[model samples]
Target: MLDLAWRPRAHLDRESIAIHLGLERKAPQAALDAMRRIDDAIERVRTFPDSGGRVRLDALRRTEYRTVLANPYTVYYRFDEKTLTVYRILHQCQNIDTYALVDLPR
Candidate 1:
């Protein structure tokens, strides 16, 4: 089975969990819980890369990229024949077009 690798942006994505949690009035543990869920989802992605929805990008010519939602956040990933690359994690409400992820490494 292929392993899933997180791109640099994915690391920033993970940080967003704490950012969101900090913005909320909820307990600090809630951020930890969200991180745990994202970790679990990443594991699942390693086993099933296509578990995410096929993302259609106008800026890009292909539909190879996909996204999986983890509650208020969405995980964007790309898969080549041999590996899965997690590109970014963004809040669901964010305007995805602003990210310009079409240049992501395949």
Candidate 2:
């Protein structure tokens, strides 16, 4: 298995989701469940790096951008021989191509 790494935006995104669900929506249990699901998706990706579906964005087509769905959210990542780098964790309703792909290293 490749080593796992998280980009800063990925961390912030996860934290923001937790805050929004737990504090803003007053759904602390839901927040925890969401977090667990995200973690589970990450683990699944770690075990099978190519298991995620390839992202279908024109600009990202040349690169191996992939996503693992976690119900209402998605985990976006790119993997090399030695590492799997998480780029972002975003809500399913968001325009991921516009939001997550920006500022990512090609």
- lDDT per model, in order? 0.74, 0.89
Error of 1 at 41 (Å): 1.8
Q: Cα lDDT for residue 33, model 2? A: 99
> Candidate 2 local accuracy as lDDT?
0.89
Q: For residues 23-91, could you state the per-residue lDDT of candidate 2 as single tens digits? A: 999999999999999999999998899999998888777888899999999899999999999998888
Score every model by TM-score: 0.78, 0.91
Expressed as tens digits, the lDDT of each residue in 12-103 for candidate 1 is: 77886777785665657888877877777767777788787887667543657788877777788888777888888777887777354644
- Please report, as a residue range, the 10-residue window in candidate 2 with the lowest summed lDDT: 97-106
TM-score of model number 1:
0.78
**Alpha-carbon deviation at 3 in model 1, angstroms:** 1.5
